[model samples]
Target: MATLDHILRPLPLLFIIFVISSLHVLPASATSSDKLKTATTIRKVNRKGPYVGLVTVIETEEDAFLASVEFRPDPNHPFIDLSGRRFRIGKIHGKKVMYVRCGRGMVNAAAATQQMIDVFDVKGIVHFGIAGNINNSMSIGDVSIPNQITNAGLWDWLNPDKAEGSDNEAYLDIGNYNVPQSDGNNNMLGSLRYGHEQLYSVNGHISSPQNVFWINTTQEWLHLAADLEKMELLQCVNASLCLPEKPKLVVGLKAATANIFVDNAVYRDFLYDTFEVSSSDMESSAVAMTCVSNGYPVIVIRGLSDLAGAQTGTNAIRKFGSLAAANTARAVLEFIKKLPSNYNVNS
Candidate 1:
C-alpha cells in the first residue's frame, strides 16, 4: 500500500541492486578487513585542450610525399581541408588542427613554425619528420630522441678586441653572435625549463667541444655537434617571446641518422664501423633545441630504413620511410589525445 511515487523511488535503487547481484559482482579482497562498496563508480574523464598544431619540414616533393601518404582524411572531421599550399589545416580528430608545410632548412622551418604559432594561435606544436642516424649502434629503422642539443659550429672563442672595438668588424661580430641567455659557465640556473628538465646552451662554435661529431670523425663536427639538426632552432626559440603565452613544443618521431647521404654509401662499412652515425637525413636538431628552450615536453620517435654497412644496396629508405612516418604519425595522434587539461601556462 505504498504510493506510486514511493514505489518508483525504491524501484530504481532496487533494480540496480538486482542487476549487480545477478551479475555476481564482488570486489576483490585486497586486505583481510577491507570493506567493499556496493557499486563501483566510474571516474569522470577530464578532457583537455585538443592538440592544435603539428609541423613538418620537407625539402623536396618526395619528402612531402611521405607526409601526404600518412595524412588521411578523418571521416568525422569533414571540416578538415588542406590549404592551397598542401598543408592540412582544419579540424582533425575533433581539434582545430593545422599542419604547415614548413619548407626545408633552418630558415624556412623557423618561418613556418612562427606563423603557425602566431596566426593559428595553436596551444601546442609537434615538429615531426625524418633525421639521419648519427650513432653506429642505431640501425636504418631505429629512431633517435635526442634530449641534448649542440650547435657544432657555434662554440669558437670570442676575440676580446671585438667586444670593446668600434669598427664594422666589431659590429658584425655583435650582429652575428647571440650570446645565448646562459650563465657564462654552463650554469644550470639560467637554463630554460622543458617539462621537468632544464635546457641551457647557446648556438655558435668558437672552439670544438670534446663530444660533438659531424659525418667525419673530426674536431669540427665534434665542436658543432647538436642533439638534432634542422634549419629552424634559433628562430623558433626566439619567436616564442612574441606569443601571448608560448605554445608547448616537441620535435621528431620518425627519423634516422646517417653518416652519409641516402643516395651514397661507398664508405658504408667505415661509417658503420667508425663514424658514430647510422642513418642519414636533413632536419631535427633545430626543432629539438627550440622545444627545449621553450619549456615543452618532447619525444622523438623514428624508424630505420637502411643499413649503412656492408648491406648497402637496399632501397630501404623509401619502403621504411613510409612505414616509420605512418607509425610516428599515429603515435603523435595518440599523445595529443591524452594531453592533460592543465598542460600549458594558460591552463
Candidate 2:
C-alpha cells in the first residue's frame, strides 16, 4: 500500500496533466506552422513596390490632389481594378506612391484601404479628404490633422420601452429621435450609443477582443504635421467667393468617422460633447483602423467644408467643397515633403 504523502504527491502531477489536456492551447509547432503559411501567402502575391499609399474619400478630393501635385502613373503598371475598386500605381512628388479612392461609407473605405495594403507593399498611408467641421473654433477650409480618431458609428441601439439588459459599458443616450420612416409606417429609433469597434486578432498580434476606441496617429508623423501649423490656407473659393474668415491649420485634436453623413446640429453637438472630436467624416476611421491593424503607420488630413449642422442656412460642403479639397491637398503635399527620404515603414 502507498503512503498518504506519496498518494498526494502523485495527485499534483495527475492534476497538472488533466489541466494541460483540458486547455485549448495550440501546440507551439502549430503556431509556427501558421505563421509560415501566412508568410508564404504574402510572398506568393507578387506585391508591388513599397510605396506610401494615398487615399481620398471621393473623386472630387482626388481631382484636387491631382491638380495640386503631379502623380505620374507607373509606366509598367499604371492601375488595376481589385475587388471592384481601382488602384493606381504612381509617383507623387518624385516619391513612389499608390493612390486609391475610399468611396463613400465605412465599408467602402475599409475595403479600399485593405485592398491597397494587400495588393502593394505599402510602407505607410496618408488619407486626405473634406469633412464636416464640429469644433466652433474652426472655420470652413481649415485643415485639421487630428492626433486621435475613432469610429463613432458603432452603437448598442436599445428599445426605449425595455430596461437595459446588457452588462457592457455604453456612452451617451441619443434618444428622442422618433423620426418617421420615408416609406414605412414605423418610426426610426435613436435610443443609445457606444464607441469602439471590437475585434480579435488571428495572428496573435493583439489581445483577444480588442476594444478599439481612439486610434492615435503616428507620433512622429503628427509631430511632422504640427510643423505646418503656420502654413497658410485658402480663404477664398475664388476671386468672387471667399470665406468670411481666413482658414487655419488645426492640429492635435480628435476626429470621428461614421457611415452616416451628419448634417444635423443636434447630432453634431452630440459628437463634439461626447467624443471631443473636431471633425467628422465618412472614411477616416476605417482607413486608420485598417492600417493600424496591418502594422503600418497612417495619418489623415481633412479640410473643413461645412459646419456640419450648425450652418446658418443649407450645408456649405457643396459650395466650399472644392476649396476645402484643394486646401487639404496642399497640406498633404507639404506633409509629404517633410517626410525623410529613407523612413522605416514600421517606425
Candidate 3:
C-alpha cells in the first residue's frame, strides 16, 4: 500500500505538468495568425531605396538582355532563392542596376514592380522587352519608346440602355467606376480593382486595389532616348537568315497594356484609333502605375516582334522575337550609358 501511494503522488505532479503545457500551447488558428503577422513585419522591415530598376517579361527577353551585360549573382539579395525567376545585379555602361524578370502579365508585372520598390531602393525604372505592334507604319524589330501607357482592360461596362444619351452609342466606357479620385500627384495615387462579375463569368475573384492609369514616362528619360544614335540592330536569327529591312528606333509614341494577349487585327485597329497607341503589351502599364505610386520615374522601350495580327503569314514573334529582344536591350544599354549619374528625380 505504501509503494502504490508513492507512485500515485508522482502521477498527480506529472498530470499537472501536462496540463500546464497544454495551457501554453497556441491554437492552430492563432498560430497561423501569428505567422501572417510575422511575415508582414518582415516585408515591412525589408524596405529598401535609390537604385535603378530593370524589368523584362519572360526568360527569353531576360536572357537576351543579360547576355549583353556582364552580371554576377548578388549573394545578399533576398529574392535569389525564388525558383523560375531571374534576379541579378549588373552594370550597363558602368551604371549599377538590378535586373528582374517580372513574369508575363499585368499582375506579375505589378507585383514585381512593387517588390522592387519595397525591397530595393529603386529611384527610377527602365522596362525593356518586345511588344506587338499596333501601328502599321512600324516594322518588325523596330524599337519603340513610349511616352504614355494606359490600362486597356479597365473600363466601365455600361448596359446598352444606359448608352442611349451618351455621345457614342458604345456599351463600354474608358474610365472605371471604382477608380478613386486623383490625389494630385500626377493622377498616380489611385487603385484599380478587377470587376470580375462585370467582365467575366468565372469564379469572381476581385484583385486587391492597385495603381493603374495612363501614366507617362519620365520626360528626362524620354529626352535622353530621343538623343540616342541608332545602333546596329539584329537583322537575322541565324547565319543564313536576315530580316527584309533594318530596324529603326522610334521614341515618344503611345503604348497600351492589357491582360489579354492580343492577336486580332480588329482589336489592334481599335487600340490604335482610340488611344493612338503605337504598341500593345501585357505588362508596361502595370509597371508604370507601380513606379508612379513609389515616386520612381519610369520608361518603357519595346521592340516590335509582330504586327498584332496585321501580318498574313507566320507570326513574327516566332521568327524575330530574339532579334526584337536584342534590339531593345541594345537601345536600353545605350540609353543607360548616356544617362547622367547625378540625375535626380526631383530635379
Candidate 4:
C-alpha cells in the first residue's frame, strides 16, 4: 500500500532494479506519441572503480589532442581505433582515455561516440568545441555555459511540397517540426526535448524567452536560438544506448561561435545588429545536449572570440578560445581529481 511518491523515494536505484528485475514497464499505458510529449528525467548512476579522468577537445587540427595529452601523462594508454581512417588512443590524468576528431556533423559525431563507448570504454566524454553567440550581452571574449541546448535548425525544412514518405511511417518529431529520420536509432535521430526542470536549471540567455534567465543570472545578454544548432547531441545521447550497461555518464565542456566567415565585417555586423550575437564559432550546444540526456553532468566554459561586427576577429578568437579551453580543461581535471578512488554514486 505504498504511495507513488513513497515508492519513488529511492528513484536513483530504479535503473538498477529495473535492469536486474528485467522489467519492461511500458510507458504508463500511453502511446509512443504521448510518451514523446511527456517529459522524462534521465537516471544517473555512479559506481565504484579506479577513478579515471577524461577530456575531449574539438579542434581544427589533429595535433590538438596531442597538446592535451602533454597535460596528462599515461604511457599505457587506452586507444580508440576507427579502422584505418582514424586510430587514436591515449591516457590523461594518468587514466586510460581516447582522443577522436568527430568530423563536423551529427552522423560523424554519433559514430565516433559509439565507438568510444563501445570500443574504448570511456566513462564520460567532454566535447570541446566552438560556438557562435547571438546575444549582444556577449563580448569578444566571453564564455557561455548553457544549461540546455535545443536544436534550433531542426524545424526549417518542413516543405509540404516535398513530403515524400510512406503514409505508415512516423516522422521524427523535433519539437515544432517533423523531419525524416535517417538514423535508425531513436536516441540519435530525434530532436532534443529536455525536461522542464533541466531546461530551467540551465543558466544563460536563449532566444526562447521561456528558457532565458533560469538560474544564476550573472550576466545580461540575449542570443537568438538558430535552426541548425548542430545535430550532434542526440547522437551522443543515442550512443549511450549502445553501452552494454548504462553508466552515469557526463558530457561537459565549452564552445565559441562567430560568423560563418571568421573574417567578414558585413556578416559580423549583420549578426550583431540583427541577432545581437556577441561572438561566433561552433560546437558547445551539441556537447551540452548530449551530456544532459545521457544522464551525465556538463559544464560549459567559454571565452569571447570575436567582436560584434569585426571583419576578422582571429586574434581575439584565438586568445579567448585558448583561455576558455584552458580554464575548462583545468576545471574538469580538478573535478576528476576530487573524485575518490572508491567513490560510489548511485545511478
Candidate 5:
C-alpha cells in the first residue's frame, strides 16, 4: 500500500477541484433556468390596458356584486387571475373598466390600488363601499363624497397632562413628540421607520404636525362627484327595507380612514370634532394615497351603514349595509355614464 499522506493528498485535491466545478456548473444552470421561467410567467400573466379601475372593500360584497352586474364580461377576454386576486375586464356604460375587490383595511387597500395601477394600467380609480356616519345630520343609506381623507390612527399618543393647549386642541401638542413609526401593526411598531410628518390639515388648516396623514381627492374627480351628487340616490334596497329618510348625496365633506371598526361614541365624537369628517371607513384614505402617488384621480363614495356609536342597540350595518352598498354602486355607475367618451385621464 502507498504511504497514507502521499496516497490521500492527490485524491483530496482532485475531490476539491470536482466540487468547485459542480458548484459553478449547477448554480449557473439553475439560475439561468429560473430566469427563463420567470420571464415566461411574466409574459403569460402581464396585462396591457388603458383601463379605468373600480375598487370595493371585501366587507361589502354587495358593492362588488352591484358593480360586477353593471359590467358585461367578455367570454373571449376572461378576467386574468393573479394568484387568488382576480382582475376582471368588462364594459360599463360603454367604457373599458377593470373591477377588483380590495380587502378591507389600509394596507390591503393600498396594495390593491397600486397593483391595479402598475399591472393593469389603471388610468383612474373610483372606490365605493359602506362607511360609519360621524355626522349626526346623516342617516343610514345617505351617501358621502369626501374631498379629503385622513388616516385616523397616524398619531403620537401622549398623556393628557403632557399635552399642551386646551382639552379641545390638546392632541395637537403631541405632534411635537417624535414617536416611533408604525405601519398600523401593533407588534411591528418602530421597526420600519421613525418620526411623523404633518400630513393632514383640518378643513385645509394645519393645526398639528403629527397624528394625521391626509390625502385629497383630485379636483377633476371631485368635480365629477359634484355632478353625480345631483343625481337621485336609491332610497331602498327592497320592499322590506326602505330608508327612514330619502337618501341624499352629500359632497365636499371630509372622511377618516383607520383600521379600527369604531363603535364607541367617545371616539366617534373625537374623530368628527378633530377632523370634521362626515364618515369613517377602513379603506378609503389608503386608496386615496395610492392614487395620489400615481398621479391618478380618485374619488371615494361611501354610503352610511351605521351611526358609528350613537346607537345603543345593534349596529345599523346589519340592517342597512346592503342599502348603502346599492346606493354607492348606483352613484358610481351614474358617474361612469356621465364621463365623456373622449375623457382622457392624462389630461
Candidate 6:
C-alpha cells in the first residue's frame, strides 16, 4: 500500500536490488537445457575419460555390478547427485567408471543418461538390467544384448474403426461403449493405436520428428559383444529352482521400451510378430536415445526375467530377477575385461 515516493524512499536498497538483478545472479531456464547435448560420438567425447559408465534401472540391477565388479569409489569425488539420481564415481575391473542407478521408467532413464554424460567424463554407457521376454524361444535367466532399442510408448489412440475391416496395422474393434470379449487371449480388443516415440537429430541443438521406429546402438560395441554369445550364463536360481536349460547369451536381436509393463499374452505376441523385438523393458530405449543424441556409444544388457505376458502359470520375475541380473553382471564384466587397455573407453 506504499506510494511510489514511499517505495523509492530507500534509494540505496533499491540500488542494491537493481545491481543484483542487473548482474543476472539467477540462472536462466535455458542454462540446464543448454547442457543437454555435448559431443555426439565416442571419438568426439575424447580418450581421456577412464570411465565407461555403467547404468542400471533399479537397485537389484545395480547389485549385478556390486556382486562381480570391484568398484573403487572415486578418491576425490566419490558421488554426484543430479536429477534425483546419485552417480557413484569409481573404477571397476581396474578401469575408470561411474555407475548410476537410473531408477525405473523412461523419464528417469533418459534424465540419468543425460546427467551422466553432461556432469561427468563419461566415455561410453553400458546399461544392464532385467526385462520381460518377447521371444518365446528364449527362456528365463538368459541375457539379450540387442543391436537396437526403440520406444513403443508414443501413441495415437484413434477413433474406433468406424469403417469396419480397415486395413490398419493394429486396430482393436471396440465400438459404442462395447466391452469386447477376450478370445481367451488378452488382445488389444480396443480402438486402434499407434506407437514409436519421435525424435530425429537434425543436429545437437535440434531434433525433428521423423516417425522412425528404431534407435540403433553403436556398431563397434555390438560387434565386440558378439563374442559373448558363447559365454555361459547363470542357469540355477539356487538348488531347487533352475532354468530348463543352460541360460544363453543372444546378441543382435532387437529390444523395445515403453512405460507400460507388458504382461498381456496377446499384446506380447503382437509385439513379437510386429516389431521383431526379443525383449521388452521400461528403460533401455530412453537410455539409448539419450546416448544417441549425445553421440556416445551405448549397449543394453538385459536378463530375461519373465516372458512378457506369455509366461505360463505364475510370473517368475520376482523369483529369478536377481539371477538374471547376476548373469548380466557377469556378461558386463567379461565385456569390460575384453576391452583393450588402450581403447580409452573410445576416448
The segments of candidate 6 whose C-alpha lies over 4 angstroms from its true place after superposition are 1-50, 162-189, 200-209, 343-347
TM-score of 6: 0.77
User: Candidate 4 on 230-281: residue-level lDDT in tens?
Assistant: 2111101133322122111122221223113345454444435533334344
What is candidate 3's CA lDDT for residue 201?
Answer: 10
Cα lDDT of model 2 by residue, 125-171, tens digit: 99999999999988899999998998888877766454555554354
Q: Across residues 104-124, which tens digit of lDDT does each residue of candidate 5 receive?
A: 899889888877775555679
- Name the Cα RMSD for model 1: 21.5
lDDT against the true structure, per candidate, is 0.38, 0.76, 0.69, 0.36, 0.70, 0.74
**Predicted candidate 6 versus true structure: per-residue lDDT over 1-347, tens digit per residue:** 54434433333353334333433543565242222221112212223365888889888878767776466676656665444577776666667777889888999888888867754566789998999999988989999999988787765565433343433234433342234645322433446554555665535445455556688888888888999999988888899988788999998999989999998887888788877899999999999988887788999899999988786788888999889999988888888767668644421
Q: Which is the better candidate, 4 or 6, if ranked by TM-score?
A: 6
Query: Which 10 successive residues of model 1 have the least lDDT summed?
Result: 37-46
Q: Tens-digit lDDT track for model 1 on 1-347?
A: 53324323433354344434434543463321221111111000012223355666553322433344334433333222111234454443344455665666655554555444433334656666654444445544334433333332222234433233322111112222235633233432221111111234233333432233221111221222232222121111133322122111223222323222544344444333332334444444444444433334334333344453335466555544544454345445544444443433222
Question: Cα-based RMSD of the predictions, in order?
Answer: 21.5, 13.0, 14.6, 17.3, 13.8, 9.9
- What's each prediction's TM-score? 0.43, 0.78, 0.70, 0.43, 0.73, 0.77
lDDT of 5 at 268: 86
lDDT of 3 by residue, 234-303 (tens): 7887888678888889889999888877788767887787678999999998888777655678999999
Error of 4 at 335 (Å): 4.4
Model 2: per-residue Cα lDDT at residue 344: 20
What TM-score would candidate 2 get against the native?
0.78
Segments in model 3 whose C-alpha atoms lie over 4 Å from true places? 1-49, 70-79, 82-85, 164-213, 343-347
TM-score ranking of the models: 2, 6, 5, 3, 4, 1
Model 6 clash pairs are 40-295, 41-295, 46-347, 47-347, 263-309
Q: Rank the candidates by lDDT, best first.
A: 2, 6, 5, 3, 1, 4
